[model samples]
Target: MAIQIGFETLVEDLPGPRWQALFARLWPGYRAWFLRSGAVARPSYLESRRALRQHMPELVPTWQRLVELAGGGDVEARFLSLWCPPPYIVGCSQAVWIDPAGKEEPALLRNYDFAPALLEGSWLATRWQGQRVAAMGDCIWGALDGQNEAGVAASLSFGGSTVSGTGFGIPLVLRYVLEIAQSTAEAVALLQRVPVSMPYSITVLDRRADWATVFVGPDRPAEVTRRKAVTNFQHRIEWPEHARATHAAERLERLQKQVDGPGTLEDAIGALLQPPLYQSAYLRGYGTLYGVAYRPASGRMELLWPGVRWPQTLATFAEGRRDIVYTPGAEAPPDPDDAALAQLLTESRS
Candidate 1:
C-alpha cells in the first residue's frame, strides 16, 4: 500500500461560497469539532483579522467568516487548513498512508485516516491569532505543514533534539506570516523582531521572491538566505556548526547540486518531489506528505503529493492535474462567500 495525495487550487476571485461549499463536503466534521474545542475565542479571531486587514483590507470579510466558524467550534480542523492559503512557499513529507494501493477512484481520498485526531487537537491548541492575523499548526487536518495569508509557510521534520517551552509554534508563526505580510521581506522582518522559544526550522518565501530560513532553538536564532530553493535543516550563511546529520539537509544539498544549471518550475518541483539523498530510517520517517509550489508572478499555486509508492514522481494539482500545467498568468476567481467571514465578527460577539 502507498500513501494517498489530494490537490486543490483556489483562484483569487473564486466566490467564498464555493470554498465554503467545498469545505463542507470535504471535511464535514470540522464545524462540530471547532465548537466543542472552545478554541475559537472572540478576541483572538478579532485580533487576527484586524492585523490581517492592516496588510490586505480585502481580507477583512474573509477573516470575519473564519471568526464565526471559530465561535461555534463547528469549524472542523480540516476545514481550517483548507480555508487559508500558505504565507510563503513550502513543501514537506510525512509517514502515513490513506491507501497502500492506487486503485481507488479518487486516489488519495482514503488516506485522510493516517492523520488522527490527537494531531488535530494539538494543532488547534497551538493556533495563533491577533486583530489582523490567524494561523494554526497541523492545519489542513493535521498535515505537518501550512501557512496563513501572511505570506509564510511552515514545514516540519522529526529531527533530533527536542526542546520545549513553546513560544509560538512554527506552524502558528507560518500562519501569522501569511496573514500579515504582503511580501517575503515583510515575513522575514516579522521573524527577526519576534521572540520565539522552540527548536524548529521555518522557510519563508515572500511574494517578491526573497527566501529565508530561520532556525529557532533553545539558544539562538540562525538564518540562511535563499533564492532558488529551500529544504529542511539549516541553509543560512550565518550558521556554522548548526547543521544536523539528518537526511533532510543532505537531500536538499543534493538537489541543489543537480540544479546547478538553469531549471524551470517543473524542474524545481521534480527535484523537490524526488526521494531523499541518503537512504536511511529518516527517509521513511519524514516522507513527504505534500508539496506546495507558489508562483508569485501569476499569483498561482500548486499542491503536489506522491500518488503511488514507487516509480511515479509526485503530480501537481493546482487546478486539476492537467488544468494549468504550472504556467504563468493563470487566473481564477477569489471565493466570494468567503465574504461571510465578516459574519464571524457577529458570531464571536455572541
Candidate 2:
C-alpha cells in the first residue's frame, strides 16, 4: 500500500497572505524538532527568522506563526515525520512524464492515490506544505527525494542490517544540505561534519555536475563511495557480513552494468524503475518509493510516483503555472522518449 498525494501551483502567483497562513499552521512541529536536536548552527530561531526576513520578508510572519504553534504543544512526534528547510533562492530544471494529451494511458508518471486514513485533516495540510518554501520544498518533498533549487539532489533507502548510525535521518539531512549548501562539493563537505543517526547511503548531485555517494555510520564517515548507480543500501565496501548481506550490492552491480551499456540518465532512471534485485529476499522488502528529475537551469522539478501498487508519473514546474499531471498504469519503457529529455540526459551524462 502506497500513500502519495501531490498538487501543483505556481509559487509567485499564490496569494502571499494565504500562503503565509498555511506555513504558520505547519511550522510548529518542524521547528520544534530542529531546535530539540541542537544541531541547528544558529541557536536562536529568531536569528534564523531574521536572516530569512532579509531576503524573503514575506516569510517572517510565517516564521513567527510557527513559533506560536510550537508554543501550543500541538506539535509533537507527529511533526518529526519530515521537517524540511525553507526553499533556497536558486535555479532548478526538471522533467517527468505527464499526460500532455490527457490520454489517461497507463504511464509511469501519474498522481498517487493516498490512503484515506493518511488524508485526515492536519496530516495532509502539514505534509504538503506546497508553495510555502518553493525552491527549498522541491528538495524536501518525498516525491523524488532531492532538492532542485540548490542544484542538489539525493535519494535514500533503509539498509536494514548493514546500516548503523545515530544522527539525523537522511531525509532531514538532505533538506539541511539543500538549505545550507550551494554545490555538491559543499553539500558533501557539510555531510561529513553532521552527526548522522542511522547507517544509510546518500547519493548527492550538485549543480556543477559533481556527484558522490557517502556511506554514514554512528561513529564516523565510513566510506565515500563513488558510483553512478545507487540503490537503497550500501555499495561495494568491505564491512562485516552482517552489514554486507543486507547492502543490496547485486542490485547496484546490475544497475551499473545497465548504465554502462546504455550510459544515460534515462537509462539510470529506467533501471531504477525496475523491480527489486536482491537474491536473499531481504532487499525485496525495501524498493524505490519514486524517481525524481531536477533541472537546475530551468528551476523545474518532476516526480515519478510508482510505488508497490500505484504506478504513475507526475510533473510539476517551478516557473510554469499549471496543474499536476497524473497518468495511470505503465506506458512504454523510457527510451529517450522526447528530444528535450534526451538532451537533458546527455548533458547530465557529460
Candidate 3:
C-alpha cells in the first residue's frame, strides 16, 4: 500500500482560530512524543517558561498567546516552550550559494531529510513578532527553516552528536532567529547566547551575500565559521554510527566541492537534487523529503520535489495542501514518534 503525506499552508498575523485548529490537529501526535519519556523527563511549565524568558524574552508574549489558544494546559505550555525536551535528531544538509548568473539573489539551499511520517508539513506565513516571516513549521509553532521579510534566511542541519543538555530545541531557536534577526551577523549573535539541547549547524544568509554557519550545543559555546556548505557534523564526527549511516562525510565533501567553485543558482539547486545530498533512506529515518531554495534578496522561496516546484512569498502566500504518496514499511527505526506520527497521518486522511 502507498502512504500519503499531507502538507498545509496557513497564514495568520497572530494567534487565533486558525492557529488553534493547527494545534488541535498536530498536538495529539506531538503530545505523544513529548510524553514518550514520561512527563517527568520534560521540564515543568515554570522552568520552561523561565528559560524562554531568559534566552528569548521577545518570544514570551507570542508563546503565551499560543498556549492560551491550545487551552492553556500545562503540558501544552511546556512542550510549546521547547525547553530541554526529549532528544531527537535529523539528517540534513544546507548551503549558501551566491549564484553567479545574477538572475536571482544569493540563495540559501536546504534538503530536509527525515522520516516522512514525522514531518509536521505546515508552511506558514506570519508576522507574530512584528516582522513578517515565512517558514516551514514544525511542532505546531516552531520553524524548521525560514526567511524573514528583511531578506535573511536561515536553515539548520543536526550536528553529529549524541549529547543533550539544558537548552531549547533547534526548531524554536530557528523561529526566534527568523523572528528577530535582520542579518547574518545578527543571527550569529542570536545563536551565541541561546543554548541548544543538541548540536546543530545553522546557516544564515543575507541579501548582501554574507553568510556563516554557527555550531551550537548545550554543552559548549556557539562557534561561527565561513563554511558555505554544511552537513551533519562540526569539526569532527562525534557520532560515528550516525555519520556512517547518514553518509555525513560523503555528503559534506560533495557539497563543499560544488560550493567552492563558481556556479549559477540554477546549477546549485540541481546539484542538491542529485546524489549524496538528496537522500532517500526513508526507512532509516533519513530520506530527503524536499529541497528548498531561498532567495532572501528577492523575498522568494521555492519548494522542490524532483520536477514539482511550489513557490511562495511573504507578500503572496496561498493557503493549500499537497499530499505526497510514499510506499509504506521502511524498517521502522527507533525514532519514538514514528508510530504516533504514522497514526496521526492516517487519521487526518480519514
> What is the C-alpha local distance difference test score of each model?
0.36, 0.38, 0.85
TM-score for each prediction?
0.49, 0.51, 0.92
- Candidate 3, residue 47: the lDDT equals 98
lDDT, model 2, position 52: 41
Greater-lDDT candidate between 1 and 3? 3
Worst-scoring 10-residue span by lDDT in model 2: 86-95
| RMSD value for candidate 2 | 13.4
Tell me the deviation in Å of residue 33 in model 1.
13
Candidate 3 error regions (>4 Å): 101-103, 327-350
Question: Candidate 1 on 1-350: residue-level lDDT in tens?
Answer: 33223333332232244434444454434444334335542124344344345533544454456434443343332234232321111223221111123321111100011121112221121222332222122433232443344333434432123343324334444555565666557766766654343444555544343455556554566454452333444434232121232244565555555445344444445655555632222111222343444433233333454442211111221222211111112223323542332232123111
Backbone clash tally (model 1)? 64
Worst 10 residues of 3 by lDDT: 341-350
